[model samples]
Target chain A: MAETGTSAARSDAWGVWGGNPPRNRGRQPGELETDQLTIAGEQLPSRLILGTGGATSHAALEAAIRASGTGLVTVALRRLDPGAPSLLDVVERCGVRVLPNTAGCYTATEAVRLAHLAREAFDTAWVKLEVIGDEETLLPDAVELVTAAERLVEDGFTVLPYTTDDPIIAQRLADAGCAAVMPLGAPIGSGLGIRNPHNIALIRQKVTVPVILDAGIGTASDAALAMELGCDGVLLASAVTRAEHPARMAEAMRLAVDAGRLAHAAGRIPRRLYATASSPTGGLPW
Target chain B: MQLVVNAVTADVDDAATIADVVRDLAGIAEPRGVAVALNGAVVPKASWAETRPADGDTIDVLTAVQGG
Candidate 1:
């Protein structure tokens, strides 16, 4: 059932998504065994990485995280209100590996400074480097992001670069020693769902590290679609925690990722624009 | 006593809180959006009201970060 509703949703990019000329004759008999989720050198069980932001409130965020069953959670280190909800308390309660992000830095130097401070505070080199080129789409500045990733990697930080789903760019990040390459499915906050599944496929095909389908996931189906497309993981926030039923959506997303993983291993039939009858006919010899 | 806060080793009364240290710094006039860490661990925002600074304890005040 993983590809049942999933194909309908991901049909937008079919021309590109499934257009890859056959590489492997067919999947191996057993399920595809992907490398464990390890950033820098730490191992994580859950491939579906969830973000703890944009929720209605701290309470909602906490519930959604619990529902999602995510072992790695994203936290932003920034100036909060004098009496606003405390990030420390929230992250602590989530009890997940903290991934601090360099979300708004315009330049590599700024990103490095924040990465250092975050490393000092969180005591982890797992930093999400988001150097956006354009503010409107929140797209990654490939040039700046690559520059920052190089520096952070040199400094011993497991830089996770959030970038477009371009194979060449994703390969660059992997070569730069990024623990993982998070190629956005679309824009940062658009929630338009997976806009370019093929690009994500290409990124997955090239990168040796984890390839996370990040951003623009609008609903549970969208997350499932990513996994079915062969991505090792999914990174999203608004789709699950901001929906009318956040907890329900969180549960759905959790299942979606798992189901999709199994499906990818199961191997899907080659998709065709024209449907053909499955039953074999003997040319009506009778 | 004149003290250099967050810049150099400084001096203050025995019971001075982190707020007092930031406010008492020589040139730092504003103390908003600043998180104080006594020694290394962060002092909880709520506990800051009642917590007091001690001698020889390194106090680091970090500014607010703005990112989306």
Candidate 2:
């Protein structure tokens, strides 16, 4: 593992592929390697955070989570349902950390209350704060989100707010002492992919905390694009859960996140309008 | 005493504790992965067996569910 700085925006590129033991994995002589995704001083195994929503069954959800190689998975707190199959059982079996979210809340008080309940229910202080503004878009209410984030942080909770791609809101959340800021690419479950890559990049520049691209992902390419846009990680649910073969899609996303992270580190060639010959002018044969 | 449990009106014994309502009324066989909130404040697991909710008090029993 590479030595990490104490800064909040510490490099997320320290993790090896999938954060798994690289015993027999193929590697070149001098290839760059990384270790784990750290959030709030806790290390996560992978950069992809899977949301346990919209799955057809527990069996399928478990398979998808395993395939994705995600170290953290999001769950929501809801009214107890005795008849409903236990989601905790599957998550515990998978062995990933549960990140409870305030998904349906529209106000700061509601989200704060849910966070408290989640802390007791899950026995963890980590929360994925979400205060929605509009029901149609499921966008974060900027004011309410900041307020809830501040309150949660004050109460010793590690808050990660799901917010807009706007750099200003992202900065505000970070300033509120949140562990991380999750900016959406589009509306929740819309699968539209990153609507504004520029804003995501700007957010990366603005916030010191980790930037996670949450929601509005349709496929593996979208996940890859998020990493390329400088997001530390990606969070999505319907993209994999709603797919015909969730496990397969999960695998694709896992690979894409790895590939994209490496590509981002490797850096891409600058785009040029005019033609640039690969063959040297003097070495070209007549 | 009548207490609102998870939005449903439940008639419970006057001495019913939060744990009682959770186990008997909410039908949670095992309290693992379960949490209770009296009114709007969360009640810790250690206090559930001793804390009794008053009549008309809202008790929200929450647990982990598949969601984002």
Clashes of each: 1, 7
**How does residue A122 of candidate 1 score in lDDT?**
66
* DockQ, all models: 0.13, 0.80
Scored by lDDT, the top model is 2
TM-score of each: 0.73, 0.90
Alpha-carbon lDDT, every model: 0.72, 0.87
Model 2 Cα lDDT, one tens digit per residue, B1-68: 99999999989999999888999855655577788889989899899889989999999899998997
Q: lDDT score of model 2?
A: 0.87
Q: After superposition on all CA atoms, how large is the RMSD of candidate 2?
A: 7.9
Best by TM-score: 2
Tens digit of per-residue lDDT, candidate 1, span A86-188: 5557557778777778877888877877777677556777888988787887888889899999999999988888888889999999999998999998897
- Residue A189 local lDDT, model 1: 66
What TM value does model 1 have? 0.73
Poorest lDDT segment (10 consecutive residues) of candidate 1 chain A:
A15-24
lDDT of 2 by residue, A209-248 (tens): 9999999999999999999887899999999999887876
TM-score of the first chain alone, every candidate:
0.83, 0.89
Error of 1 at A121 (Å): 1.4
CAPRI-style docking class of model 2 based on DockQ: medium
